[model samples]
Target: MGKQMFSKPPIQKSHELLLPTTKESCWILVFLLAFGVSSIHGDDGKIDFRYHHYLDLSRVLNDTAASCHEISRVYSVGKSVEGRDLWVIEFSDNPGVHEPGEPEFRYVGNMHGNEAVGREILVYLVQYLCSGYQAGDARIRRLIDQTRIHIMPSMNPDGFERAATLGPDSPRTSTSWGSYGRLNSERIDLNRNFPDMLPVWLLQEESQRRNHHVEIPEWYWDTLVAPETLSVILWSLSQPFVLAGSLHGGSVVVSYPFDSCGLRKVMRSYSEAPDDALFRKLAKVYVDGHRKMGKCGQVEPCNARNFTCKGGMTNGAEWYCVPGGMQDFSYLVTNCLEMTFELSCDKYPGEDELQTYWEDNKEALLSYMEAVHTGIKGFVRDGSGKGVANATISVEGVDHDVTTGELNIFDIKTYFLIPQRLTETTGDCSFRGLTG
Candidate 1:
């Protein structure tokens, strides 16, 4: 089949609020998007949902980018330990361009290379988004028109190759005790290699402890960091990502932030964040949309690993203390509300089951993408109507605040757009001095 041109979809009606501004200070005009979640259909049996090698995945992304040039494009964030590109395929009305007021969302899969289910599902999701938009699927059209969706199908290509070499049915790789090919080429657990805030928080006085938008610690450089971890960290800090999902396997549940706990070495402790309620809501969106995962806040059978989660959602720390996890890094170090989705109990499921897994997760994936637009998003501009740089925006009651400014980490400079006032739907917001 040849490429098809997709006509632009009409913009949906957005509720715009224009607050008065002064010449000396910048004002923020916040608007809310009409929240609508719907199932996406249009499985044309064209794009195959199979386990892809790094080269094959690259080609798939490239081909999709060419076919869906109007709404999708491919780019690489960085390389893995073994020099594999950490490619990201983005879908939007205007591909590769950042549109003001549009929230950016991302899904990162195969962080643990052995957990191949998410990587394959994400690849399927890429094809679905592109095909759905081209096929005039209304829900998908809305998603592409309103939000920038970035999907990195594989974050640990080196480990993935290792796992694929062992084959899915290999007893050594399939065993619960053995975590073959789970680490990157450097043999470091990427999830646990990020700068841990638990250590920093414990050392700080209660009054001095910073929870939200936490900075990377200086001593973190003294330790060995995985290339994949650094790449993701730098990539995240460089953007104004509003929402994200880290896909994993070996469990079937949705878990939200504070993956690490203040209580040292605690196996089961609830380390809740200030935006705990909002995080729970975000996590529940996926769970409720999932076909098997029952409604959030209610006990449901997962049917895998004999696991049952109340509402198929859990607080990350309560599930298990994972120090330096990506979920926590996203919430604390960047303007991204991240959740970890344990998509399947089988980490390296057979490729033949990819389509079934995709069918089970398609709605949940799309619904979560739609949820990004459910929050307040707008622009911080000066009296001249130009975006004000280095503006710190905060809600009256929310403990966390987002900044619009330049951040220099590991000597790499990152400039971020003004993030959404991620707080209550109805609340007063305050902005700090314009440093632009």
Candidate 2:
């Protein structure tokens, strides 16, 4: 709530099956579709930019781990409606352990099955990180050494299978591209399937409106939420995420929370969060890092939409109301600061265009990850030198506050650092995993 400044930096499951059958046998079709079926790497050692089957995705992640075993590991968060594993590849110096004072960052792609760009681009990112670190890229090494990065390339795999057409050679017309793969196997829109908290926020008094870590209602558990949504909820809560990016498609802009404006669905008014300035800065980080996004209407995707923002950034609700969006949920229910990156005008682009997209967004992705290191972080300890648990870390005049200890959905706890400008008057900064 105050602008004060400082210098510098720091930082599973099993299910059984209902396989969808196409005109071609799934296995044979997938193999033929993958251009070079044996390897994902090209002659120059860069990943081939193309659409990949779920099996191909798994292989890419595992192969990366095997090749870069010292700094990476592959794991599954849960299963989808059609029994596909939601795989996550984590990059850290200590791989599986949560290092003290090290922030956890995540990039979740393809929440919508038709939004294939985010999914494939993330695979490119995985390859870039592992290869860059192995090649002794100083910036990449610094990121891997100081921060823990988790990337789930495709969150809705079942929908992706439905959306991705025959192979790289198959024709994708305008009619077929955007319509088929937007939802999950249950026909649920994963983006809108999370619990909505707009009503809850409206009910709270003005002073209590900016409250963080709002609990999920018990009734939410009994609803018809998609399995994919539930999987992400559990995964997001189980870790201490400092910053997150939800990659999407259909337009090119960066959107920050609060995404919904209670009941007034049709109105295009801004719903400013308590940390609005901080959120705007985060969105600008991506916009400025990209080649064309910051130019706004001058770029291809931006011009297509006729969108005009100073830096191709807009508040989520102002752009258009999106209730139950993951971007809003990440901030409301957890300590994570999340934003949505709409990467292209085409939701599902041709395989030929994947390489261009990777080049366009690569810098922005790395810069955003590096941002997790710019904030303040420390522990909340008592006079006895033991860390204090369930403690609230409040800043004067800032409505939103972070808590210390562990993180979980039912009773969530924050990990580290408020990125905003702070002074001594704004007391109480705390961290996670520091108990004696």
What tens digits encode model 2's per-residue C-alpha lDDT throughout 1-436? Answer: 1111222110012110011111111010000010111111212166767888899999999999999999999999988888899999999999997776788999999898888899998999999889888888787888899899999999999878878754432214554443467777777788887878765656664555444556665556656777678878777766778899999987888989889886677656898887787787777778767777867446754453354345688888887888888978888776788999989877787788988888778878887887777656665554454555545555554455665544322333324555543333322333334311
Taking the candidates one at a time, how many backbone clashes does each contain? 1, 2
RMSD of each: 9.8, 13.8
Quote each prediction's TM-score: 0.82, 0.83
Regions more than 4 Å wrong, model 2: 1-45, 166-179, 206-210, 301-305, 407-415, 425-436
lDDT of each: 0.71, 0.72
Among all windows of ten consecutive residues in candidate 2, which has the lowest summed lDDT? 26-35
Expressed as tens digits, the lDDT of each residue in 133-250 for candidate 1 is 8888888898899888999999988888888877786423434223567887777788888877655655653666544455566667657777677778777766678789999987
